[model samples]
Target: MWSRALRSNLKLSKSEACIFFKNKIRGASTCVEGEPEGPVVKTDIPGPKSKQLLQELGSLQQVGTIQLFANYDKSIGNYLVDADDNILLDTYTQISSLPLGYNHPELLKVFNDQHNMKCLINRPALGVFPGEDWPKRLNGILSEISPKLPNITTMMCGSCSNENAFKNIFIAYQRKKRGDVDFSEEEKSSCVLNQPPGAPKLSIMSFKNAFHGRTLGSLSTTHSKYIHKIDIPSFDWPIATFPQYKYPLEDNQRENEEQDKKCLSEVEELFEKYEKKGIPVAGIIVEPIQSEGGDNEASPQFFQQLQKIAKKNNAYLLIDEVQTGGGCTGKFWCHEHFNLETPPDIVTFSKKMQLGGYFHTAEMTPRQPARVFNTWMGDPGKLIILQTVLRVIKEQKLLDNVLHTGTLLKIGLLELEKEFCYLLNSTRGRGTFLAVNATDSKLRDEILTKLKAKGIQSGGCGSNSVRLRPALIFQEHHANIFLDKFRQVLKEIN
Candidate 1:
């Protein structure tokens, strides 16, 4: 069914089909090396030059978490060169943000074009004074991606995109309940003091181990780390469990389905409980893959059912695609694979999109202006880059590359899991956005650290999972390098 849908949607004729099949069989992308010929390590990662800059930056603000300073000019394609001239294969790609790796000629062309300079220099308060080309740019985005949501609200980043999306949902929820009625004087006056009746008690339901963002409104929905929330006050929003699967997935299919049912039940119950508490949930926010919390995945059935629960309770559904957007997942939007009954009410995206914001349903658009206003709602300069990035993805067919490369990664990891059975398990993810869990947190950290020392940069999430957030240009050759380094580390540990 999925393949048929893909074929139907793709609509390839005989010649197109022949080329795609030929590429698939030959692994055409694997033949093209995107990374530099060799990674060079001239000095320790944070050697002298980076340490000096860290000290200077530390004098201004806290710089404890600073890594080696990068020489962006020297970095090319998938390899990152540090200030000390240590070139490492970068898999994290600036927290999974860079779409085309470093210094792609197409992206560089943007800087060379003088006409785009005006939008970059004279930035406007987009809500009130959008540039003349704003609508045209937005039209391009809508036509290209859209995610089945006809409306859009551009914001500044992941958190604010989700934050403002929540506001849009809340306003639509309220407006549906109170049609043709003006705001009462008492309601307007009381809202100034942040009390109920005027402010109205409403909530957004999020799942356990989710990381929405650090901003106040988004923080209320982020449940991953206590450090991000300990000192800050937050809303008493309903938190449901995201399904935890036992691997190998085929062996644990029945158990995983049961886990899905158990979680979906809790979601329905929470909606009722919150309503009884006088703060009904106005929307549901979730990550397609629970990234940051450890690349946790749920069955497509789980997401489909969860959407039904949201609709049943009249809560808008918002998929937080902050970390999963772009072509890393072999699709422009990861949710495209789910075959959702309908498009989500809102899909918030950032990181690789080059701009942060959301595609939402027309119903979610606010009736009044300034309800979702912000200075520089989104940057036009970023949109210019995004437009270019979209062109590169299509012209190069990067999504096909992701699919081929991802299979190489998944198969290699499965083989590693079999060999290193005692140390790791639960290797999972869609496309190149993959991960494997260590037996324990300490072991996970140790393996990650060792991989870094071996000239491969990786990232960790949750307690025991090592995540792969490679650039869209990550070819199978890069995957083989990572797996080779990874196997060496595992062998040494054993």
Candidate 2:
């Protein structure tokens, strides 16, 4: 049925056809041919080889976060091959960046095309000397994947995208105030000196526990972990509480609704407080779902109201979809689920999108060039890869795949939460971007360690949540493997 549907809806290339037919069996053990049938833990996770590699790498720089050294050549599909030859089913998906898993055939063939190889090798300072096809390329790709916003500014990564986006927000804000006028001499000179009227005392309000990025500007807004911010000077911008709801949402509707109200009320208060402090908020930035902060989710109504608050305060709403975009939440962008009255003023994305950038309204476009730019505003090479990723996603109906696989994964998690009530709870999130809370941070770490030992490489978030960030290609069979392993771990703990 899947193969017939693919054939009828679109013409598959010889390679694509092979991929589909190879995995067409009703209960196939693996999706990618030559991929492992199941994980093989030849040794402990960071077994001898990985430890030796880590020791060697530690000499160059800080390796505190090094887990295991991967042998990319051996990895395929959802399995990660470590230096020790241990094959682990990877649910974290390279911190949720690998859209198609390791070395997908289509992606590998991308550079085989001479034009693409040229794009990759002959890197240009895109800001000044872009290829003639750059505009056409952007239009073609953005036409397929962009949010409702009409303008876009390509960037390098999540942090750089968010950092540059702050410039756009501030520029637009001041432009509105100084409508149709050229900058005065004082404004120009003051800006160079980092003073008022030019580099204004405007602010971008962010939510507590939000992770925008780690760059200086974006870092000020990031509050996920203190280690990422300790001793670093930050702006005193307003910080509002994000909605925290009790789980099994149907059971605690009233309390959750009240929680939404409390958060929204706090947002309003902060806007007023910041205005009184003379650093009026120029914009409000938030994550659709706080991925790094325990996969925290907010109600659709909460977001709808939040958007209204931003508009009322004459501030732009920037939905930082760095972790929630690119179909992870069953929709291409997670905010699509909110049903807002209007599109957000800015929607920043990275990770699965292949490159960093923001979709924004025309109002956010700077009056002058170089106002929001860098040497390589963005890599044409990444766009080439993204072109293929988007094509595969559409041609393969991967968004629908995400919806189906996510249902299986979330249902299994909910069931586990019930069975291991003392050890687990709060199974939450949309699509494959789900998470579940353990008894505490300590137990959460233990659960992750045990799962890793059992050949399931998952990840944790916030204080105690296990986050699932599987690739879009992840299917029901993969979900079953994870659930079976997770159940085993929970049973052993119980």
Candidate 3:
């Protein structure tokens, strides 16, 4: 029934069919072989069924931010099906985490093995009593994508991964400072009271408009929004200005270079200011691309210089790949594009990787057994899925697919910006990690709402930017559908 509806709704001209839909799988994308050809907007977005489900969920817990309830069973590939049966092309891909899209047969077969099932059910306190296979499994993860780091400290989510990473940075910093000396009685006692020289005033310098995480330690470095940290107590850390580049990078080369210099100078100044104020910066936690805060990007030079700044201050550089990792930006890690002098001191990840964890250098290794410990450090179940995810990513050459699709997506956005100059601009990003700024915040929200009505699920960041986070499986055909719909919507609004 869905396939029939799709065929009728997407019966295109010969040229259009050749460009978009081909020999696609039934009920999948019209253009792709196994996904829906086009989005289906049968009812008003967040239609009655979704509204009813949301109300039910709200009664049980907070659902104030719930826009619509998904019918997970019906969702597939690059499309999400809401409870009302509205099928929307999901460019944001659950905020850029769904790697292979919903129910990719490869992932579903992961638990088919009885051994895999056993591992999933028999949870372990990995910090203390890891399973026999734990060593090999972790090694496999590290070997494939460790950012040249030697060790892994697994945690629960992006927030905790970063929180524990903060602890690791502090411990390593103090270890270097104290020169392997045992803690003095006064030092121990002062720590209990959370005083200086024990608790210490070390800070992690972060960029303005950067989002690390929401845990107490990570939240201290997050500068994205007020809602996430409004009532929460935060650390008084140095907030360096991030580069705010002008659009058409080539056209504004001089201006953008100035922007980078201005931001980099502020960082240099903050380091001096923090030191003089007696709160030494022990580390810097940053997203290569400032996601959530905005789809703001920096030049390769910016990252290269940022690394130098950290090294000069003897600070650990933690690249928070929680959002930008897992092949979204065409690389196994987004920071790989920077061509840094050395791998970052630490790299944190979660989201598409299926679990939260930090990979760090041997220097960052904790001397004490339980210093960065947690019960059930991370779910083995998530590992099982991750193992499969990694395998599928390799077998299907998904990283290459991302690079291909990302270029197509960025080009479409650039072309759309040209036609709708008043409404869109600043089409920028690496790989599929792309975005365009709307005229204003109000128009941004309106565009997002109308896109959903036309069966496109996009997200907003910074204040006025529309971000695109299509899955790795997203192909040129998918880009064409998106561009066509985008053009239609721009015409509607313009």
Q: Which pairs of residues collide in model 2? A: none
**Residues 10-37 of candidate 3: C-alpha lDDT, one tens digit per residue:** 3223443332333232222222235677
**Candidate 1's error at 243, in angstroms?**
0.5
Q: Sort every candidate by lDDT, greatest first.
A: 2, 1, 3
* Pairs in steric clash, model 3: 21-31, 24-33, 25-33, 28-35, 28-36, 29-35, 29-36, 29-37, 30-36, 30-37
Task: In angstroms, give how far residue 329 of model 1 lies from its true place.
Answer: 1.1
Listed in order, each prediction's TM-score against the native is 0.94, 0.94, 0.93
Lowest lDDT 10-mer window, candidate 3? 23-32
Q: Of the candidates shown, which would achieve the greatest lDDT relative to the real structure?
A: 2
User: How does candidate 3 fare on TM-score?
Assistant: 0.93
Q: How close is candidate 1 to the true structure, as a TM-score?
A: 0.94
lDDT of each: 0.87, 0.89, 0.85
Off by over 4 Å in 2: 1-31
Clashing pairs in 1: none
